[model samples]
Target: MKLRIKEVIKEQGLTVQEVATRIGKSKQSLHGIIEKGNPTIGTLSDIAKAINVPIYRLYEDDNDLSDSPVIICPNCQTQIPIETSIKIKSYNHD
Candidate 1:
């Protein structure tokens, strides 16, 4: 699923570096997440905390989360696209 990390960060007035530091990740690593759309659960959780947003918000589809203008990877310190490599699924065993 596409994540809205960049939009949430911007909405919270957070810089990529700040989010990276808060999440114990390098800017490059975080950038890779933005570009590659693959972040560890721990990283996503930390990002959720840093931005004061729910994890689901990051995966919301209505806001064009994947089409965000930029993303910073803490691993590689690069800015890249937010297209997601994995699809999100909702569990409803009813």
Candidate 2:
């Protein structure tokens, strides 16, 4: 799953080095986090703080999905569609 961080970084118009400095990490370290693609929530929180955005923005939104309910993988940023089927069981007890 991907965090879509690269896109956010680009949108923010801030270079990786700039963010790394704000987050107290090195550019290499920040790149490693993106390369790993499996950052912890705390890590994400830190990034959000550095980028001055809500953590949720790091994930994909409705614009990224189609007819199905889709969730983005934090490590790979792939959209996974969820089944929207309902199952109901009717039982009679006398």
| RMSD of every prediction | 11.4, 7.6
**Candidate number with greatest lDDT:** 2
Candidate 1, run of 10 with poorest lDDT: 63-72
By TM-score, how accurate is candidate 1? 0.61
Against the hidden reference, what TM-scores do the models get?
A: 0.61, 0.62
Q: Residue-wise lDDT of candidate 1 within 1-94, one digit each (tens)? A: 4677888888888899999998888999898997788877667878999888766556646545345644545565345565547889999998
- lDDT for model 2: 0.75
> Ten consecutive residues with minimal summed lDDT in candidate 2?
60-69
* lDDT to native, each model: 0.74, 0.75
